[model samples]
Each structure stands twice: as structure tokens, then as C-alpha cells.
Target chain A: MTEARATMPPGAGVVMPIGGAEDKLGRMTILREVIRLAGGSAARIVVISTASSLGDEITHAYLQLFAGLGVSDVVGIRPENRDQAGDAALVATIDRATAVFMTGGNQTKLATVIVGTPVGDAIRAAHLRGAVVAGTSAGASICSEHMVSFGSGGSTPKFRVGQVSQGLGLLSGVVVDQHFTQRNRFGRLLALVAANPGQLGVGIDEDTAAIVSASGRLEVKGRGVVTIIDGADVITTAYTATGTQPLMMSGLTLHTLPRGAIFDLTTRRLVSAPGLPDETEPPKVATLADVPEDMRPRTRRIAAEGAHTTTAELRRRPASS
Target chain B: MTEARATMPPGAGVVMPIGGAEDKLGRMTILREVIRLAGGSAARIVVISTASSLGDEITHAYLQLFAGLGVSDVVGIRPENRDQAGDAALVATIDRATAVFMTGGNQTKLATVIVGTPVGDAIRAAHLRGAVVAGTSAGASICSEHMVSFGSGGSTPKFRVGQVSQGLGLLSGVVVDQHFTQRNRFGRLLALVAANPGQLGVGIDEDTAAIVSASGRLEVKGRGVVTIIDGADVITTAYTATGTQPLMMSGLTLHTLPRGAIFDLTTRRLVSAPGLPDETEPPKVATLADVPEDMRPRTRRIAAEGAHTTTAELRRRPASS
Candidate 1:
């Protein structure tokens, strides 16, 4: 089940952007693909925890999940501020990894901590050197050239309700939003893209992932759809609408891609049907029993806490829900 | 082209909710239909100006529009506060109208002034007595039982980001959001309905109308689509997700109805193909000259000022944009 993905020539790896709360436990379809793309069981992965505010727990959860899936060479890195983001030690960690996965938190905080630093450069370098790069939620958002700094939620694109920030430019000319359908962020993303017509809008629904091959083919994976909003033919009031007056935009095109759908970002068009070959069935869905016996109680405790479940618990939950 | 709509027996009229910025000048498809439904040349329409903050200008726009369409029997009424909303004079004006139209502005202010007042009661009474009841933008929002009080815009639905208030309750078991696709409000409406699963979510795109007949048939009209979000099978974290964490939801169904589509609100199912007979071509799109000679300057001034164009200019502007 292994491939030479990790040793592929520079500029050939994939960038996977996940809508938040991806199905980590049942069928681990997206995650297993991440591992296979990175280097299967031999993958050396780096988990980026700068976007997360919950600290090391988020990092630890990813480590456990990867280990349980048989990838024990994974490590986590956190560059707390611009100063830490410049740390050579952190850059080295990213440089050595076959894959880099960013956890979700505050995208603004993530960009503020690392956007222009050495760690950010290392990430770009890793992608250029054929290492798969992936991010979930906030992590997913920062993989593009432009990122949503923050905004209000609604169906209308009111004036001044949203802000934009720079992202790590691993993928360009598109603004990516995670937790698409679950969060209902269609408006804000439309507003941002309307304001900047050069960039297309990519919205990923939770439990879904859009894997962008270096060839510009974006394939949808997992349970939900990836919505692409193209503003090329738009006529919008994004420039002149005053106050809370709703922006008037006509001619924008929207394409929703479900599992196995492929889109070409370079041409800004939906590719013909029949996307890349589907991955082999996910390595069997791991249950709580698969967690190291020592780590079982911790997983149970996180679930008991109720409101926020760590990645470890989410990865081991029963499939029915 | 006129029908005996206004003279129909009690409880047999329609409620038209127009997403804001319905074209007034070019095509005038929606506004013309409003006139035809209200009795065309014989109609006496009441303009409810409580939702607008722009003094009488907003009222003037509609009066001019309907007049240009040959319905000269229109009057404007403004209930500035709850006291005015309770005024018997205002109620009497509503009592005599063949149709009632509420303009767009702020829903909260509109509701604060007239939600349970005599004027509001009179409008409802007019509907029951076989008169058309219609609203646009903020006015459109108040047609539903649960109105969005105030909220931010984005794709993700965060806790406390949105608040709902009582509307005119002209339509129940659903919350209506206007400027749907143009405004990108899918998330907030989804959140509101996710919390109150008992209520279905209806989002109307700008320049569009959803006309609910007394028979519980909702027909789509105008240029855009009406999105119906049904959460009957939803499994969500709306009740438990902590601050800023994206709510997890699954099994929600979304149906987008383009112009000419019909939906059965009672059964919450899309009606079969072959909707109602289409309306005749609109009385020629009104040009600026159709406006009274003296009103042309104000209309031109509103456009020349840029940024914000009055409804009059919006109505008369050449339709190509």
C-alpha cells in the first residue's frame, strides 16, 4: 500500500485543505489518504500547532492519532510568535518532515504568529520540495494566498462586515474557507471574492477535503462537497454599497463538487467527470480499543468533558453518528 | 391582464416577500406583479414606511413606481414608534387598502415600532380580508414568524453571532432571509433553524420573491432562487458547541428553487414539475420619463451621487448592468 510520494521530485506533492471537524474516527478516509500521500507507514510528519490556542493537547491528539494509524515518526511544532516562528530549530523540524498538518484555531492568530517568518518559509519550501501539506479548519484557511481574517455570519454581504489577511501562499489565486456548509459562510466568502475578483472562492464543508495536486487539479474527498465560487463575470456593489445595504452581485458562478469531483483551478473550470483514481479503502476504522491502553482514560475524559472533544476522541468514536 | 385578485373573498390572497433590490426600472417584473395582484388600475395600496430610516423618500419611490405602473391609488403611512403604530388612523388606512407594502430598512426598528401594534394588526386583517401583503428586504424578513434581529455575516455559525426576534408573523414555521445568494446568509439562517428545528429556513435571493398562497403553496418569482433548508433529519451541536467553535451538523437538506419553481410549505416537499401558469410579459419596463417630470432630478441626483442609488434611480436605470 506504499508509494514513493515522499521521495517525489520537488514541486509534485499535494496540498489538502479540510473543512473543519473532519471524520477522524470512522473510515478515516481523508486522513488515511494524507498518510499515504506523505509516505504511508514510513512517513515523517510535522504537526503545526501555532493556530491552536488550546496548546499542546491539540498536538498530542494528532500525534496519538497518527501513531495509532501506524505512523510513529510524527512530531509537533509550535512557533508561539514572530520571534519563535523565526527559530531555526522549528524550521529544521518542518524541513525534515514528509508532510505538514496544521490544526485549527484562530486563522488571524495563525497568520500573525507565522505568516512571514522562517517557519512559514519552511512550509512553503516543504511544499515546493514535494512534501504533502494539509490543514484543517483554520489550518485549511491559511493554505491559500488570501485568508479570511474574521467576519460576521449571515447570508448577506453587508459593507465592512469582513476582513481579509495574508495566508501562506501554498496555493494561490483562491480564498479558502473551511466548515463551509456547517458554518454557512457562503456570504462572507462571496463578499471577499467579489471585492477581489482575481481570486476564486473555495469553501470546504466539514468532514470533507479538497486535495490540490500540483497539476492544478483539485479533487474532492470525504463526505461533503467543496463549493467553488467564481467571480469572473460578476457585477457587484462590493465597491459602492453603503452601510448595511446588501451588495448586489450578478453573474457570479457557483460549482459544488461532491466526493470524487475534480476542478481545475488554473482554468477556473470544472474538469470532466472521472477524477483521479479513488484511494484504496481506508485502513480499517480504528476504535477506542485501538488506542494504547494507557491513553484510553484520557480519551474517555475528553469525551466526558462533552462540549469540546479532542482529535483523539473524535478519531475513535463509533461510526453510526 | 388584470385579475379580480383584490376582490377575492377573505383568506384567499397572497403574501409576497421580495428579497431586497428588486428591479423597479428595468423589466419591473416583480413590482408589476405586485400591482396586478393588488387589482391593477383599481387597486388601493398602503405603503408601510416604519422599517425605513430615510424619511419619506423610500415611500416616494414605491408611490412613483406603482403610479408609473398605472396604480395611482397608493398612500404612505409611517408609524414612528409603538404609540404611532397603535394609532387608529393608521389602522384605518390599512383597512381601506387592497394591498399593503412594507419597504426595506432595519427589521429591528420596524418590529419595535409595529410588531404587535394596531397598524400591524390592520395589515394582517387586510391579508385575511383578501388583500395582498408584501414586503422587501427588511420588510421581507418580518414576513416570517422568527425574524433575524441582528447578526454578523460569515460562512461559519458561531454561538451568539446571531439573534432572532419576533416578526410580523405573517408566515409561520419558517424564518425568511432576504438577499439570500447575493448576501451569502446560508450559515446564519442554518444556525437559527438548527436551534429551532421546528422552524424551516427559507432564504430569498435579491430581486426574487416567494409568494405564499393561502393554499400553502409557495411559488418562486423574479430573477433569483429561493433556498429552503430543511433540518428535520439534522443531528447538530447547536446546543452544546462552545464559543467560536464551529457547530457540527449533518443530515440537513437544502433545496434551491429557481424562478417558476413551486414548493409545498405544508408538506415541506418540492412540488412536482409544472408550476403555476406564468404571468404575462411586464408592462413595458418603465423609463425615467415614466416618472413624473418633477421627480427626475431627484432620481438622477441619487445616481450621480454614486455609492448609494435611490430606489427611483434603481428602477429607472438602464437594465443592462
Candidate 2:
């Protein structure tokens, strides 16, 4: 059925990692971007509920969320174990998807179940062909090559206090951690980067997303800031730090960016964000009952500036010859 | 000259590990007890300031505190490196002392500088021969076989989020952490115990001390509570948890104890605290301005009960033939 509809957008290799608990209701900025990147109303989104412990609950939530956003064709593929992850029908569903989203739960369980299987391959193939790939929380964490398996968050990085596992490899040479600032996960992410100094550590705060394009450009979206930890110049005592001791990590560069910020991941530099709509009408928007309580005045300013990309705007197709 | 004075109380094999920042001022309960354990004014105390980064500052502070508590023969030994730790005169001073106290700083540096030196051997020898061995903060941490070198603290134990290093081994099969509650070090201690289930994890809150007697009976002293983590029954997924992922640690037992509580470490059971002084006098004690502000009503109640364990009481000699 999917093959019959030959108008599918060639995958743009877009990846959006939402730092768990992104706003599902008001504005739904991050989620809407997922839909927009996947070709809006014409999108065929496949929700991978493999990481979710809630079983059908998470899958149903995404399916309903996309449907509410005016996307009619959305489906869910849940594989409980490796055997099911390789199912031909499930792999086919991934192949047909213009967007693939993995929900949050346990990254270890998710990777263990599908990483080497046919479903994982299909997801990668779809991304390679230009499909949008996005995830939330554990799902977001698994998008990187070196995934943070589990660890407690703290202010100081300790030696070997965290565990790292292989991930889906959608984002190479990167470590992604969701619910960053909210959970005080700076330590864990920094530790991961210190352990693997060559990798980039991208930490997305709650309600935010770091959207990476095929061109290696990353743009911030949603209400929260994205923290980037660059360890290229880090001089760490991680090698000599014995069990649970705090590590001495010096000279690591950190960048904290909010919405409308553009970063060039390949060049390891910040690309100036395009001029956003004028931000002078914040107080008036704050008085509007429709604005989310969690969305600060700054976010409200963006909303008032007409920076919102509505479903109608997303549905408009690009002109073709 | 040391042999001529000859009134050393035979070693009591007492090991007191104080969480950092014990009160040095009004009603110094913890420090006074250290003086009492070391035979009051007649005590010959050796202060080891190897862990301190502030040089003479830490040593001077300890010397004054001990002197104020009526211990006159207090002397300090500052070893910046392992070579200094092996000094013959320093080892000789430890040999003649009735009690040894280690000051706080960095545990990793302390252990690295002294653990294998002659001074380290003398500390163990002094402890074995019954001299009271006490330490605070980093000093307290090095009493165990496995020391928590450094790590950030959190509520959940993640996979390898902490580092562990070798310690002085004064308290076998144990790991000690100072400023436990004050620094929120519960997670690191739990992670340490989860990694080495055979070792007992003792987390002493600031201003509190866990005094382990020769018989392995642990008595709590001072204002703050002592957190004991027993992981012998813990069911953990640490073996398989890759990278900084939170571990599934189940069935671990936790005991939070305060002053006057007694515990048998060997048997892992609560040894009923000797009837604590009546708690009825708390209101009157709270009204007394002489008491420290940080001392809670419960601690004041004990203080009013004449449970002060005065230096005069310690100065009384044991009846000898």
C-alpha cells in the first residue's frame, strides 16, 4: 500500500532528539516539527514502541498525537524481543515510513532488542534514504553511536560511575542525553564525553529538541535550552582517577543555546540563527490563556512574533517542476 | 623522653570516622569524645595532614581544636608525597601516640601519598595496638579497604557513575564517605556497595561520627545521622548495564541512624543503644543559648541528660594492680 503512493519525499536525513517530557499539549512545538519534517499531512510515520515499557500505551499516545496534528496515515511497530524485531512485516512498515520515532523507556532494553536486527537495519535504511528520524528520552539517547546505558546525575564527573552502551548509530560520534538540566545530568554526559573525548555530548533540556540536518547543521527548537559539551580540548585525569573519585576535566568548551540557535556540528562552531520574528509583543501573549504556564515569557514572545509554523503552513507542498 | 612519661592507655582499637565539618565551637561533642577516647589531657595525639591541599592551615586548625578540647600533647605530621610519608621520625611519632587523627582534603591524594608508606604501616600498627584512630572528611574516607575517590551524588545508583580507589585498610570490608547527607553522597555510596557487595558502605553525615570499636560494634556520635547501606541482598543488573544507564538495584537494605544508636557491623544488626538519656529536657536545652544553632532538639536532649562524657570522666584512671 505504501509503495503505491509514489509521492513520498526522499529522506532528508533529518534527526530530532527530544529531551524527554516535551510539551505534548500547548504549542507542541517539537512534535509539530517532527510532523513537518516528515512531509506534514502526507507523512507516513511509524512509531517504534520497542523501548516503551508501557507497551501499547506509548504507541497509542504518539498515534493519537500525530492524528490530532492532521496527519492521517500513522502506524506503530512494537517488537518485544530480538526475534520480533526481525519480523518481515515490521521491517516493511519501517521501510514505508517517511518518519520513524522511538518512544522513551529503557535504552538498554531497546538497543538489546533491535540494534542488530532487521528492524534496526530498516530504520537506518529509511534514514539513509531521507526519512526523518526522531525520538524522546530513552529514544533520544539511543540515537547516538555511544549511548548512556544508565547512571545517576551529579555536578562533578566521577571515574567510571556511568555505563555506556552501543546505540542505533543514527548520529555518529555523538552522545545524546535527554531531560538534561531538569535531571542535573551534566555530570553523566560530561563523564561520557571525558571517557570518549572524541565524541560530542549533546544534552537537550525538557521540552526541547536538537534537530540535526543532513548537512550536519543543528537547530534548537522548543522552550528549553540545549547544552553542548565539546571535549576536544579537555585534559582529564580520568585515566588515573580510581573508583568513584571525581575526575579533573579541564578546558572543555560548553555552549548553552535556546530556540532559534543554529550550530554547525561538522565545523564545531555556532552558525548565527536567521533573524526570528520580532520579539517585542511578549507581555500581551503572556496574558493569553492559551499559552502554556511552563512556557516562559521568552517562549511566549516567539509565539507572539508569528514564528509558529502552523499545520497549514506545513501541509503546503514545495513547488515542483 | 617518650618512654620516661609512660602513661599510654593500651590501644583501644577505636576507629572514628567523622563526616566532614564537625563542630569545633560550642559544646564540641565529637571532638571532646576524641579527647576522651585518647585519655584526655594526658593523651599524646599525632595529626596526619597528608590529604590537605591547604598545607599548614588544616594542620593548625586541628591542633588548635584538639588543644581547646584539653589535649596538650598534640603534634602534626604533614606529608606532601610518598617519600615524606616514609620519614623515620614521622613513623616514630605515630608509634608513641595514644591516638592518631587524619584531617580532611582529597581522599585520592591522601591514599596515593601514604597508603604504602611506613607512616601507613605505623597507623595500622597503632590501631592494632589499641590507640584510637580517627579521621574526618577525606580522612574518614580512607579508613576503609576501598575508598570512594570521587563522584557526584544523586538518588539513584547508575551504572559505573562512581570511581573507587584503594584506601588505608584500617576498617576492613568497609567503605566510608564523609559529608554524606550534606553533599547528597547517597548515590555514590550505593553505587560503590553495589559494585562490591561484600563491603559495607558507611555514609557519615556532617558533624557525625561512626565509632567502630575493636569488637566491630559501631556507635554513632554527634548531631547528624549515619547512613548505612547493606547491599548483600541487592539484586542488581550492573553486570549487564552498559554505560551511564541507571541500574536496577533491588532488595538493598538501608539504615539511617543517629547519635546514641549502636550497630553490630559484623552481624549486620542493630545493637540496642544503651538507654539514651531521657528526652524530656529538650525544651529547656533548646532555650539555652550556649548550645549550637545546628544542634537540633533531639541532640540537645541527650546533652541535657549529662551524657556529655566529660574530659574529667576520661581522666579517671583504670584500677590497675
Candidate 3:
């Protein structure tokens, strides 16, 4: 069925945002999905671990794991500096890759190395040319247009959870946070979205992945859930609040997409899946009515922005499409 | 110097709750610390992958990683089922281990396997005998008295963030949340603390570890900061409110301790570290007065409980102690 979809967009690659602490051993749930999206075992794979200080170890570990999984051609690279990131040979290696896996480490490190270098250009270019691009933890954080560089830590967002910096920009209109549930990063992601009210916040849980097709199709797979924070219609008192006070906001729509749930970014709704969230369950549009009274006014603001559908929309597309 | 600390507590081992996605390749900041605490290269390390569904793969990954690190004796074991968790041989391996490491997987799977069986008994016994016990992600979740098995995913705590069940109970008066900063789990951890009221919530970040000595001495290390939420004195309307309303609580003392920060659990204070916030910088004790007006009252409740020191206490002990 996936192959039969001839209407799929060009330069459309599957964007997989993995929650951190993935099961890499025998059942590489997320990895296998990446391989599947990249056209199976015959695909050329490149594993990048620039986010990791221990790059050699991550690269070698993937080398053996991918080999064990029967992928014939796999290359692992960890550039020590920008000069290495700009190497032409490295660019060539990435260019020919069908899938790219960025390991967990420091998001800043990964962004610094590949953002504008030859290697970085190759990845963005490859991703645009229908190659599957996957990242876990920091790697996942760098996948969005505005990556969260650093932030304040806590359950609720303070004045700042950290800063949002330029990311690889493979995915637009959204910011990504990895290891979502395992780390409980909802607040920081929300803060990021609140600061940049136009963007959606996608938080992927551990051992899970949010797979986004180039054509804007999304499916969540694995053990955890994907939290979607739509701040497009939020109204917050952040602009008036001073330091040390709790942040107050309204109209933020949040959706928790469990494993097997399918989402449509374009339609802005959770849709029916052939294998999961089957046809019987009617599609549910994202709304604020379900939220507590205090948070409704702000959520209602977003409703005005997207009249038919809001964040966390679930729908069952007609089978014909 | 470690041996010279004759005042060390018996059956007291340091509990390292490493946030998930640790750097296992070359410089395993957290793992190396576990090794050092367990007597370095000479220690008998037992790696438990039972928490992981992909036990074989995780076990193998750790075996190679540990071996690469040149640890002389390392054993990896993944119980195929619950019954195997009681195997005498498995118990024997744990008994001889100077350090035990639990890999990441489903916290529920791990709890089901090791909670009641000899495996759990062996782990508790190992820690009691001063064996360094460490866990990441799911492993870390199981280290607390109230394990956060699963919860609502987001930045703020909504209706109960999932549930808390029985854990290994290696650390008391505290609940552990891993991948803290990376995942933005501050709210969930706070919810756990708010529910328990008396338990301190320790949220460790990715690539970082919170080290607790047998003598109850505490220190923060690695690249990220440790978010310590003391709920011993929270004032909230959780009891008055019902269902899905945003959780309202105050006087919940929050401390973000970066690397090298020393905390005295017994004193409930961030103690003196010669160079930082130097002598001119007065110690900051966590008080209701310190918090905004909303949180002051409940935090004051904790002060009534532990008169000597309370939330965010930073006092230099008398020089002659």
C-alpha cells in the first residue's frame, strides 16, 4: 500500500524523531522503521554521531549493530571539527546514503558541526531527495527549524526553558524535543512553542519515533507517545509577567498520540490507519473543550486560527486516497 | 582516600540515577564513576538488561562497551521470563557483583521481572553491602520508593501523570526521573512529589548522573544540571480539585544544581564549594519567603518538619566537623 501511493510528493523523505533511550539491541523498532522507509536492507546507510563526544564508540557500535542486522553497506562518521564537517569526501558519503541515523549526545555539538558545512548540506539535500533521516535525543532536537539549544529545567516553564536556535530546518513550522516521556520535557517544548507562537511543538517519547513522510504524513510507532503542542492560537501573560513568577498561558492545544495513531500534518487531524486506529473509530478534531476551565480561553484562541481542525486532529481519510 | 573515610555508612552504596542516552562509547562519565565506586577495574560488574525487551541486544551492547572500557570482569544477563528472574545462578552473579547496571527498556517490564524475585532481593542486598547500583531511564525509574511507571506526557502535570507503583526502593524519600532536561519532565516529577508531599523529586538529565554516597553525601556531575524538587512542604489544591484541571501547587522548592554542586541530603542544603557563589555570596536557603507569594506557605510546612535546614539551604558547615 505504501508503494502504491503514487501521489506522494517528490523530495519527500520520512522524518523520524526518536525519543531518547531507544532499544538498539535486537529489536531496533525505530531503526528497522528507518530502514524500511529507506527501501530495506539494500539501502546505503550513514550513521552520524557528532552530538556525541564519544563518537568513535557510537559509530563503531552502530557499525556492528547495522552489520548484525544485515545491512551490507553502512558508514559511520563523527567529525571532530567544522573542517572535518566540510570535507568533500564526507559530503559524497552522505549524498549516496539512503538513510541517515544521528546518535544521541549534545544537540549543540551536532548542530555546530553539520549546520552549514558540506556534510550538513549533504544530509539536508539527501533528506529532501527522499532519504529517510532519523535522530535520537539531541539528534532529534536538531531536526526542527528552530532547535532548543539550552533551557531552564523544571516541570513548568519559567521565564525561559532555554533558547531556540537555528536547526537543520528539515522540518518546518515545528520545534522538536526528544526523549519526551522518559525525560518529561513537556514544559520546555511548550515554552519553546509559546515563545514562537506560530510553531507546533512535537515531543517524542523514549523507544518511540514520530515518522513524518515528505508528503506530510505522520505515524507514531513504538512503546511511548508523541505530544503535540499547538501554540498557533495561544494567549499568554508572558509578555507582562516578571521574573520568578509562574508562566501563564491559554489556548494551547495538546494532543498525546499513542503508538499506532496516525496524524496528518496537512489536514491537521489524526487519521484512520489501515493497521491501527482502524476505521471504526471516528476521527476526532483537536479542541479545547476537553481541557480544564482555566486553560480553555487560550485554547479557544487557536480554534479561531484553524477553524476546521486544530492540533492533535484525528481523522479517517477515505480509502480511495 | 575513599578507604580512609572510616565514617562511611554500612550497607550504604551510592545510587547513580543516570538520565537516559548516556555516552557509552569512550568517556562514559556516569559509567566510569560507577566503576570507580565499585573499585575500578577490579570490580565485578553485573549488567542487567531485564528491564529491556531487547535484552539480548542491550546486554551485548553493554558487554562490548564495558569490555572496550577494559573492565576486567563484566557479566550481562537478560531473564527470558519472570521465572528466570529467580534463578539461583542469576542470584549468584548478582551476589558477586560489586556494581550492577540496569539498561533501558519498559520500566513495567523490568519491575515485573525483578520486583519480587530473587533478582530484586539480590539487587537490594548488593546495595546494602555497599555495591554501587546504577540504572538509566527505566532503570532509574525503578530505583525510587514510588516508581513513576508511566504518566501523562507534557510540560505540566495534568490529571495524575500516569501511576506510581512499587520500585526497588534503593533510595528513600525521593522519586527519580531520568532524561530530565532533554525530555522536559519537570512537571511530572513535580506531580509525583506533590502527590507524595514528603518525597523529594530528583530529575537527572541525559548524559548526567546524581551520585549519592553511603553516608548520604550528594553531588552533581556531568554536562547537565540536576533538578531537585522538594515537595515535603507543598501547598496545593490537588485535594480540593478533581479531574483534569491544571494541578495547582505552591511552596514547592526547586533547585537546579549544575555539575560540581554539592548537596547534603541530611542537611537539606547546597553546601559550600570553595569557588562558586563564593563567601561573599550568602547561602540561599529554600524558604517560602524566597519563593513567590503563592508557594511560600507549603514550603514553610517543610521548615516545620526539618528545623535544622529546609529547601535550597546553602550553608557552610562548621570548619571543625
Candidate 4:
């Protein structure tokens, strides 16, 4: 993985920096999406479990999941070292693949084993030539130019407790954090963006995937939402702070994109989704009779028909007194 | 905080480890419980927001909340550096505090500034003299002797991604993780316990509180469940591997405790809870009338009798899943 700007080239295939912690068997919304991006059942996919301790197990798992999805020409690759990462046979497979998927593991291992190798170059070439490229967890972390190698967190964002590393640079000017909501990584991600200022922070929730097109259109798809932190125009003295302290940044724009919401990276705005703030009327609430028969008696879950996770009304409503 | 075995001193007062992301005003069950433990309105409580960047805001918020609850003597402290941490004025106040409450922020900030200070010593002294000590988030992370300083996580446990550091030794032989279910810190906690089999991992969910008496009885409180990972008799080769890898451990017991459940930390068993696995017959399902009038038309909610989150039968049945 070359350390370059996180911009997608023209005619480049779809970039799937899948949020980590995806279920391989149940639902399979994400894996199936990757296959669709790779041209459906006819797509030739290469599964790389280089970051896993159970590499063989993960490789086998992906092979089963992909095969079950009706893709016949699926292959698994496990590169132990830089030498294996540069294997001519593996490089050739990567070049011929329509989709490349990397499994979850320690991002550091993935970096040492595959980054800067021949296979890494092939993945780049394949991605540039219009082949779908996707990774989960550590894989997702590497999708952006800057990645979070390690970080200490609690409830609030602070200074000097996070480490950033170079990634494959498929998406530049953005740092990706996986298992986002599930791991409560907002603070750490905020800390990174505060220091860097040049980069945006994309925290992807578990079971979610961010579909980045060559034209800079980002579509969120999954069970949860994606949190986008824009700190470019923010003001903070955290960069000049001498000792460790909590972060203080103002004017940072936060956007939450739920499933089916479409955002444009180039425009830095929401392109398509229901309930835009400028709309005349937002989504309406439903009564008990409008709910599903099974769930109506116990609860009436209002169907959220918008790109946002919480409305202005909901956010104003206090969690407690 | 001294690094010691995880055992409570006989004369020590009650310790409340609250999970993170709680609403201070509404549904303030955990906070109310802490006040009650401190002997109600007559209690002198100290609020430490040193762990928070919004410490001033948190202090003000808690002061109002506690005052609303009828606690007249509420003091606030903000120790930013080591020198301030040893402030005699603050130490004197902490010593006399009937209940000491620390707010959430970055755990590292809490540990570094207060770990070896006079303030930390005063807190221990107060607790030993029968004063309640309560902490939330970063505060909760610092209650145990060995704290999870940093950890990379997913849905499954892995090796080397977790690192433990010293914490305020209010409790030993146990590591605590906040936002357990919501943030999915289970894998990270499991990795910690797998490596150090003698210690148990307590993963507390948000809005919840675990009240541990000096005699070692633990009662779960609040809206969510507490996941306890016991690795006392686990066997694993994960401890041997050097690089990042999948964790391998067997015989690890998992227990989920909800509100009203009482667990005996001394005996490493649940003393009082309605549904014991050894019971001859489980609970029966409820009818529509068994639920409240408002909840009658849809799903039937089983009244969680005596410590169960739901019930034995409800646990056996599936939700929307």
C-alpha cells in the first residue's frame, strides 16, 4: 500500500472501506454488497486473511460465505511475511481478481506483511483498473490515507493519547475507525482529527459499510449509522498544549449518515436522503395501529425515514432529567 | 493507586462502579443509589471532575443534580496536575467526604494525575473509614487495581491488542470495562482475563452501576446488564504467542447480571437470583393481560420477577431476532 493522497482516480472501481465486525453468515448484507460491486456472481474475488491469527479459519470462512453467495471463482490468500506478500502467484491472482477482500485482525500485522509488497502493488493496480476493493476492521482502517494504530479512550476526546499510521491511501484526507459506535471510538477519532486538522474522521459502525465511488459519492449501507467528523475549519489550541489534557475544539461539523443515505465527499454535503433540514416537513410519528402486529403491543417503534440518526427534536430531548 | 490483589478490606465502605454515558438528570437511578449509600441528605459528597475536559460543566451539573436530590453538602474538586493532585486543601476535603464521586473523561488523565497523589490516598482512607466511593467511565476504569489502559477490539477476543496499567486500588483481582454491551468491549476484556487468569473481567453496560460492599457482595443496578467474564479455570495457549493472534481459551464462564441481581464476589457465585440453571422448571410465558394496559395489544412483556432482566422463559425466547 503506497502512502499517497486519499483521492479516488477516474474510472477506478468502487472502494468499499467496510466498517469492521461484519457477520459472514447471518444477513450477509455487506459481503453481498461487495459481490454486487464486483459484478455479481460472475466476479472473480480474492480473499486475504493476512491480518488474522486464525488466517486459515478466516480464509475458509470467507470462501464459504462467498461460495454460498454463488460466486464460483473465489480464492483465499494468506501471506505470512513480506516474501509471501510478494509471491508472483499471489500477485497474479490479485491482478486477475474482480474484488479483493481483506479480513479483520491487528492492522499492524497487515501493514508489515502486505504493505509495500508486490501483492500490495497488484491490489492497487486492480483497484485502479475498476476492480472492487474492500476490507473489514483492520482492513477498514487501512482504506484511508491515515489510520489509527492505537489509542487510549474514555468518555471524552483528549490530547496526545492516540497514534496515527500511514495506510493504503485509497481514501485520503480521512482517518477511518472501525467498530465505531460499538467500541465508543468517537473520542479517539476526534482527538486525531483535532491534531491533524487536514484530515476528516470517518467512524464506521459495526455491520455497516461505506461505499465510495470513483466520482466521490459515499453511500452508507448497514444496520447502523456512520459518523463523519469534519474538523478542517475548527479552531483549537490543543496542538500547542504542552502536557496531556482534554481536547477543546469548536466549529467542527458532525454528520450522521444512516443506511441508504448518500453523501458526496467532493461537495461535503448530504446529496440524497429523506427529511432534509430544508424540507417543509420532516418525517411524522406513527400510532400503535401503524406498527407491526407482533411488536405493537409491547412497543411502537417509529420508522425513521431520514439520513439522520436523531432529529433536532430528539437531540433536544434529554436522556435523563 | 497501589497494585495489589483484588480483595476488599473488611471495614471498607461500599464502592459503586458506574458504567459510562449516563444521563445526569433523568433516570438518575445510579446517582440516587450512590446518595442513598452515602446515608441520604445528611451525606457529605465530593464530586471530582478532574477526569473530564468539561470538568467545570460536569461539576456544576452534578452540584445541581445532588442538590435537587436534597444533598446539602456537595463539594467539587479539579486537580489538573501532579502538584494539584497533592493539594492539602483537596485532600482534607476528600478525607471528610462521606461519598466521593468522580465524573468521566479520559481514563489516562484520571490515572496519571491522581494515581500516586495525596488526593488518591485520601480517597482510599475515606473508603476504608466507611465512606462510599463512586466513579463513572474513566472514574469506573480507575476503581480496579489493574486497569485496561488500551485495547483493540472486535466481536471476538484477540491477543496483544489489550494493555493493562495501574489504577486506584479500590478493588483488586478484577478489571472493569465501561459501555460493555453498547460499545462491545467484551472481546478486549476477555483477552485481558485470558492472559491473567486469576483476575475476573467485569464489563459494565451504560446507565448501570455495580455496588460492591466491603464484605464482597456485588449488586447490579440500572437499565442494562453486566457481563462478567470468569477465566479462573481457563486453559489457553494464547499467552504464549508473541505477535497479534486469535485468543484460545476454554472453560471461561460468562454471567449476565441485571438490576436487583446479587452476586457474591467472595464465593465467585450468584447468591440470590430467581432463575438458577439447576432449577427443575423454568418460568412460563405471559399472556396479553399479564402486561400493562398500554402494552397489551402487541407483545407480552414478562414481569421480571426478583432479579431477572426478563425471565427464564423470556431469555429462552427470541426477540425480533
Candidate 4 CAPRI level = incorrect
**Rank by TM-score (best first):** 1, 4, 2, 3
Candidate 1 accuracy as lDDT: 0.77
Model 3 residue runs over 4 Å out of place are A1-321, B1-9, B277-321
Candidate with best DockQ: 1
lDDT of 2 by residue, A1-321 (tens): 011110112345888889999888899999999999999999999999888889999899999999999999999989999999989999889899999999999999999998989999998898889998999999999888788889986545666767889988888767898888668776677778778877878888888899988777788887666777677765454665566654545445555556777777766656654333333435222234554445434556566777754421222223341
Error of 2 at B108 (Å): 34
Candidate 1 on A37-115: residue-level lDDT in tens? 9999999999998889889999999999899889999999988889999998999999999999999999999998989
TM-score pick, better of 2 and 3: 2
Error of 4 at A215 (Å): 1.1
lDDT of 2 by residue, B65-155 (tens): 8888878899999988999999999999999999999999998999999998999999989998999899999999998878889898654
Q: For candidate 2, give the lDDT.
A: 0.77
**Candidate 4: C-alpha lDDT:** 0.76
Model 4 stretches with alpha carbons more than 4 Å out: A1-6, A242-244, A275-321, B1-321
Task: Please state the i-RMS of candidate 4.
Answer: 19.1
Among these predicted structures, which one has the highest TM-score?
Answer: 1
User: Worst 10-residue stretch by lDDT in candidate 4 chain B?
Assistant: B312-321
**Model 3 local distance difference test score:** 0.73
At residue B315, give the lDDT of candidate 4.
28
Q: Per-residue lDDT of B1-321 in model 4, one digit per residue for the tens? A: 123245798899998899987767687899899999999999999999989999599899989999999999999999999999999999999988899999988888889999989998998899899999999988998998898777765534566767888989898788888887666675678778877777878888788888999888888888765666667755455555455444444445555566666766766666654332343456467664454443232234333344354543322333333
The interface root-mean-square deviation of each model, in the order shown, is 11.0, 18.3, 13.7, 19.1
Candidate order by lDDT, decreasing, is 1, 2, 4, 3
Encode model 3's per-residue lDDT on B151-180: one tens digit a residue: 755555555865788898888766788888
lDDT per residue as tens, model 3, A1-321: 011111235666887889888888858887778778877889799999889878598889888887777787999988878999988888999999999999999999889878988888898888888898999888898988789887654555556765888888888766888776555565677667657776767888788888888777778887666777666555454554345433444435455565566666655455643233355757655445654443323467556766454345433334443
